[model samples]
Target chain A: MNKLPDALPVEKAAISDLARQTLHGTVDEATNARGRERMISAARAGASKSNGTQRRRRITRASVLLFAAAALAVSLVIWWPRAPLTFVTTGGEVTSTHDGGVRVATRDAESVTRFSDGSVVTFGVQSAGRLEGVRTNGARVVLTSGELHLDITHRKDTAWSIEAGPYVVRVTGTAFDVAWSPSEGAFVVAMRQGSVVVEGPLTPAGVSLRAGQHLVVARDGVMRMGEGTPPTLAELAVASSDAVALVSSAAPVVVSRAPSAPAEAPPSSSVPAIATSVAPSDRPASFAKLVAEGRYAQVVTAARGRGLEWVAESASLEELVALADAARYEKDGTLARAALEAERKRFATTQAGRNATFLLGRLAEDSDGNTARAIVLYDEYLQTGGPFSAEALGRKMLAVRKTRGDAGAEPIARAYLEKYPKGVYAAAARSIVGTP
Target chain B: MPLTVAARKVVPVVRWQTPAELVQALLAAEPEAHGVLWDRYSTSLRAVLRRSLGPDTEVEDALQEVFIRFFRALPTLREPAALGSFLFGIAVHVARGLLRKRRIRRWFRLTDDGEIPEPPDDVDPVSEQAQAAVRRLYVILDDLDDESRLVFVLRHIEGLEITELAACLKMSPATVKRRLARVTPLVFARARNDADLASFMAAPDQGERS
Candidate 1:
């Protein structure tokens, strides 16, 4: 960690908290206002005394001696080490300093130092460059030296972006730092705000960065996005597989597992247009249309054609069977059972298929009240690398509990808590287990 | 020429002092001079303080300290109109000092009666939970250092200006600009993470049989 200069002992946490408290009305106003009034008045009076004499003297003494003497005094004052510059902020004060650093303080607010190699920094309240708002959205400082500091207050849902060097920082509304090192020929972006995506170099295209995350771009344009612990092998594997599965299920067809092929394959032609237009209201209408038209063959064909693929829509196997039965006016229990078994088999083979199976299981529970069968389907969906692993486990626990009462719920919840401590629905499981 | 010289001689040396100079004089035992000085720059100073301290804090207390400190350090000040900057500086110090004291008290869990409890250094279950919470919070705040955070809070939260901030802190305007550049994104990252967390938690479960 980099240590700040000793003169600047104020912690950022303390400052932020103070700012928050002051904004929230926890600080007193009347007394501070009066005190400020007195201080400024005194300073101005003194200024008039010093500058006033020079003005009056100039008027009286057109004489060379007095004129020369006045000019000399002015020069001396300007050259003086302690010559003060007027600092102002609408509601805060400039506080602390570091080598090549400064702050602007005003009542209830302060603007700290931002770096600029050769660029200018600008600030305005509310609207960008609209100095009228009581509070500023964020300050924009142009970087000339390839580095600038921007500390902004978080406005709900409002984001501030910084364009520095070859990078653009999309802020989520918190305080963070960005530095562009000309010597290194790369920009280093750090979050002070919530988080930011340091997009630049256009090499690998867009990159998303989170809080406590930093990235370094080499002069050769190689960008590595971490300084501390790099992504673990397990994490990378999970992310890769999840991405592949999610894309395969959402897209029309499952692209081959070819290493040379791009992660996102071109859309497949066989995937029906219905998958593309899978909206909430459209789900029931499409299902009804399929049933009315006796399109069981087409539904099964479509489902089979997109083998080992995930469909984000509600056109699962169970929904197809319901549509077929509604159209044919016949309930074939053997066919229904066969279709479900086939769906389960397909789901077990791939992550996307598993997600589809889970969706089908959920549809069955909703439409057919087959709780026992749904529980079995959910268990298969919870296998390793299952797309709905967390959801499947949660539903299984709920199903068992409902059938066997509270006694059965506790053990399932405990088992879930033990297996996946940070799993989705872990909190609910913990609640069931009576643990915090 | 003679009349001009006479006028110059009679003008009683025309001792004009800058606001800063008058402030210094008032602080240096000339309490009587303080009133005149106060009458001149009180409103401007108050505006600066109100903006700096924000409308939320006891602005009056901070303002009072500005005056007291102004008086106490008047002798050391060489420039007078820089009085605005000087007073602004004093205000910043006072605010930071108060905040530091508050943080220290909170960190130590100090009691109102001035008793300090033993700092919890052990990693017990309760402490571990607390540490985890603290860790998460810091993970949110860690992207920023102290200076960047202050700059962010003062400008964005308190809404201060480059010129005023530069004057108060006795720094160049450029420095404030650079600091702000670095601080904005850190704030944004934390907010984004929060939204993501909320969405993830709200996702519907597929296994739920209702």
Candidate 2:
């Protein structure tokens, strides 16, 4: 490996010179004049109150007042809200509550809590895990740890739900209760009112529960269905608070349960507490069956009906695509492409749609030589200014370069490189330039 | 008792002599503020700006603009300690914007023969010389696309950390890292060519200052 240099070369020096020149414009005398005029106007406004020789004194007083007011305003903006209170759990989950009722969700082991005013609190996890939600309600939080709980309640015309996770809980105007027990390696969903659908790779088939119904999906794909009792105060407390607080409160509850253990029999066999729901469309089993039986169109129909179209998480979409791909393995390309395209159209106005559009563009470019059309699509994606814009721009530049050759490509590449040198496609641009 | 009293009296003088206070005084439009600030930073600012902007442009005009913008924006500045970064940010923006416009103008002037006019011989060569030194230090920076070059300059030359550079350049740190990664090897290879550059590139060994 060769070493790097300590100084720049003449060409770079010239480029840097040009860079500097391009950056600094002559201070517009007019802009300066405007600034001066504003200042003078402000000063005049200050001086108009007092007459005669006292005008200078009044202007000085007014300036002081203005300075004081400005300082106060700045301080108010800076320190208006107290710093966010951060709660983090062992399994790479974090929650934050602000003075305002805004919540943030971050996963992939680290999460940040930003207040409505943009004050931030960052927390890290020692291990990989998921952070479900970081909810805020006037600085108080009910974080559910190592478990997922969904509580649905009906109030007048609205159905509300509160999803409790290890360090955060999200409340929406819907009803559902979900609990994940790491010990049992099972997830239980019990809807109190309205309807709740739980979707995940680990969710069991035929396990969609209605109000007063409960379903358990085990990690091993076991499906259990039974009548559910409304969550006890103790269970609610455990589900609503942090791990430390829950343990302390759960100790007494465990002690109390020990006395009743003798009288409790293994509940009746008729209820089938762990039996799979018999509904054809209810469970992960059903979805798996749909794929196994080559019912992709049915799966898509079911997914759309369940409002899964609105879900932005790529994992979910990937799961659906995988099912479709598996069911149509002999024609995987056609099915996957169709599924992805349909999903893209379904989500066109959504964040997910934007992502899908980028994916579609990549698929188009790589899978086919429709470079011209792909470039245009990529440009549209970039213009949307979504997270994928930089990537799209890079792809667009490459596509254009490949089709247009050096003379045609250089300007676009140069323009992109100039604007977004650190963009996702920078290496590609370099490759283009480096090519003989 | 006398010594204690004297020490107590000296505390106020020490307390009052802070950069923030001086800045505040300057904002108060005290004549002393200009002199004090100028004495403290004007020479360094001039050197950096002139070197960064090159000699062809009017350094005095740029310097005056920097100060004027600084003063106007001073009241809104939250952290006075970050004044260096703030000034640098302004300089980077001003310089980059100017350079971009110049490029556009020059691009339009390129004839059908693919010929572009050479810069005048009288062009101030100081910035050119500095840029040459920079290029010599990191040869890859010369060949890098404009965006990559700016990121490199902001990160390596300006010595901004990843996050700060990202914010300055309005880019993600991941993007910045990618750019840096792409340029790093080339820069290293170029730097290795020069002994002085090589010394700078060498990893600092623990307890081995020499």
What would the per-residue lDDT of candidate 2 be over residues A97-149, giving only the tens digit for each residue?
33333333335554444434222233322211222233322232222223333
- How does model 2 fare in lDDT? 0.46
- Give the C-alpha miss distance for residue A329 in model 2, angstroms: 80
Give residue A240's lDDT in candidate 1 (0 to 100): 41
TM-score (C-alpha) between model 1 and the true structure: 0.23
The per-model lDDT (C-alpha) reads 0.46, 0.46
Compared with the true structure, what per-residue lDDT tens digits does model 1 show for residues A257-348? 11112133223343343453356555555654543343343343343443323322334644543333332222333343444444445444
Error of 2 at A236 (Å): 99
What TM-score would you report for chain A in candidate 1?
0.26
Q: Residues B109-155, candidate 1, lDDT per residue (tens digit)?
A: 76423665344354457435323433343345434554554565455
Q: What DockQ would you assign to candidate 2?
A: 0.01
Cα error, candidate 2, residue A356 (Å): 58
